[model samples]
Target: MKNYDVIIIGTGAANIVADAAIADHKSVAIIERGKFGGTCLNRGCIPTKILVTAANRIREIREAAHLGIHVESVHADWAAVSRRMWHKVNENDSIRTYYEQFKNVTVYAGTASFVDKKTVRITDANNHTEEITGTAIIIATGGRTHVPSVAGLQESGYITSETFFGAAYPPEPYKSLIIIGGGPIGCEFAHVFNAFGTHVTLVQHNIRLLPKEDESVSAYMLQQFEDYRIQVHLNQDTLSVRTENGEKILTCSDRTNGKK
Candidate 1:
């Protein structure tokens, strides 16, 4: 059993804590189940923003007429965009290599389970396991996507924010999309895909999109979506999802009127 001064679970925000501990001459152990940079670097903010940047350029080109700049054509090469995004975001190995240079830091690439208040067992990709103890344990594991309990959703197949930039990412923009949420993630995807010429249908259980935001902001977003021809269905509760004859179908209920 190896021991350290600090055991940090997750490579996300916990990285900051690990650095601090190492700087203080304390031995540090980091357990990461996935890539080194965590969600933001691997599947979240950085990658998503790369796509968003392309989407923004497309929007600017389309709206350039308002500035009296008549552009003949605007083409979004999804292959090129994806290549660039992956090239920029695929730094996991580099991150791990950097951490390995530190003599006092032990990087465990695996899932960790608590054995006690100050001990954890880590199981790596090959099913190898090791027990490590620490004077203190820091849990900086990030949040995950909350899949709603809709019937046949799993069987129908779906991708959450985590998988959107992962192996499940489509080679190109989908022809059409049925987004089942009205929160930030759903709205952002709707905007990006719509800008890329995908017909988007957004279903929200709440009466308005961005329910957590101020009502005025939600109204403004809805108006913008309308202007962009993104179909917005508010007060909708997704009841089921199924693949029918090679087509993905979603059944939702009108929350206000109880209509299907």
Candidate 2:
């Protein structure tokens, strides 16, 4: 069994610090279960920010017309935007390359699970196992998408932010979009799609949207979303969802009015 001085289990901003150990010529090992770059580059921040920036630009253009600046309408191309973001995110050729080229670093792609306090078992994609021991271990499996227990939603073929990347833009003008959550992801998605000519309906389970943030900020965001022509539904319970013909329809009960 080969051993090392350090073992880092994630590949994010923290990796820079971990690589520093290699720079010092200390024996180093890193493991990743998925892409070389973690959630921020591969899944979370980068691509979403691209869409947000696009949305913001669209907003600026539309407002410019009202500001006495005549400008033609522009369209969003999700595929192109997604591709551009992915290219930049994957610029680092390989984590293995980083480890190999470094003075004394090694990288393995696998799942690292604790077998004991200072020891870990790494199971690779093919289920091959390696027992690794390190003086220090770091666990940095970041955030994951949380799916709500809405009726029939699982089978409804709906898309999460992960799925949204490969999802094609609606060819027909999206007359309406019913976003189930009003958290940051939901708000950002609402803004993006709405800016891209989709009429948006934002539903939140809480009394006010963005309940996780400051109350004033939530109220301000609500007004901003409304100004962007998004319909805000607060304190609504998602009862059921069904596919009619090809479109997804959500059955919801308004907590405040008891109306569906």
Candidate 3:
């Protein structure tokens, strides 16, 4: 049994915090299930926000005509942008490389599960497992995308922030998009895709876009979405989703009118 002074499960910012603050005499074994730098670095905010930046740039150039700038032929090279952004901060190549130089830090690339209070079992992709015993263990595993249970929603095909930003990057342009939620993430996607010339429709279960925020903000944001011709549906309880003839359809019940 290999023993360590401290064991951290997950490679996110929380693990970084635990790593940096440990006593100088202590050794650390960080167990990473996937990327070394966690979701914000590899999937969550960083990559998605880069796409947002590109979207913002595209929007600016498109609106440049109104300012008499006369910019011509503005286009988004998503494939190139993804390659540059991901490769620049890739965990194996860049961000996580810094820890490899530290003699006190050892990183394990596999999923870690608590065998008991003081021991963790790490299993790699090949199913080989190693048990590490530690005096102290910290769990910092991150989150996953929430997929609501609407009938046929999963089978019909839907893209959330995780899949669109984290997993799959469609090489070709997406002609139309129907965003399920109307919170910040959904709103951001509406803006980004609409700017990139995709028809965007936002379905909000709440009465307003940002239901948690002040009504004024929701109203203003709703106006902004409409300005870009982004369709907004409020208080729409999406009952189910289905595909027919290559078109995905949302069967929804209108909260305002009780019609489906």
Each model's TM-score, in the order given? 0.97, 0.87, 0.90
lDDT of 3 by residue, 1-260 (tens): 88988898877877556556444657888888776777777767777687789888988887898888987788788678778777744754454676666788787889888889999999999999999999888888887777888999878877765566555667755899888999888888788788878999888999899888899999999998998999999999989999989988888888989888
lDDT of 2: 0.79
Candidate lDDT scores, in order, read 0.90, 0.79, 0.81
lDDT of 1 by residue, 129-194 (tens): 999999999998888998999999989899887887777899989999999889988998999899
If the candidates were sorted by their lDDT against the true structure, best first, what order would they fall in? Answer: 1, 3, 2
> What value does the lDDT take at residue 222 in candidate 2?
93
Query: Candidate 1's C-alpha lDDT?
Result: 0.90
Q: Which pairs clash inside model 2? A: none
Candidate 2, residues 1-260, lDDT tens digits: the string is 76778888888765886867866777887888877667777667887797789779888987887779987767667667656776776755565475667757778889999888878899999999999888878777777788889888978867666565445534443667788899988898899888878888888899988888999999999999888779998999889888898888888998988899
Error of 1 at 94 (Å): 1.2
Q: Residue 101 in candidate 2 has what lDDT?
A: 78
Q: After superposition, how far is residue 46 of candidate 2 from its true place, in Å?
A: 1.7
Model 3 residue 146 CA deviation in Å: 1.1
Which numbered prediction scores highest in TM-score against the true structure? 1
RMSD of every candidate to native, in Å, equals 1.0, 2.7, 2.1
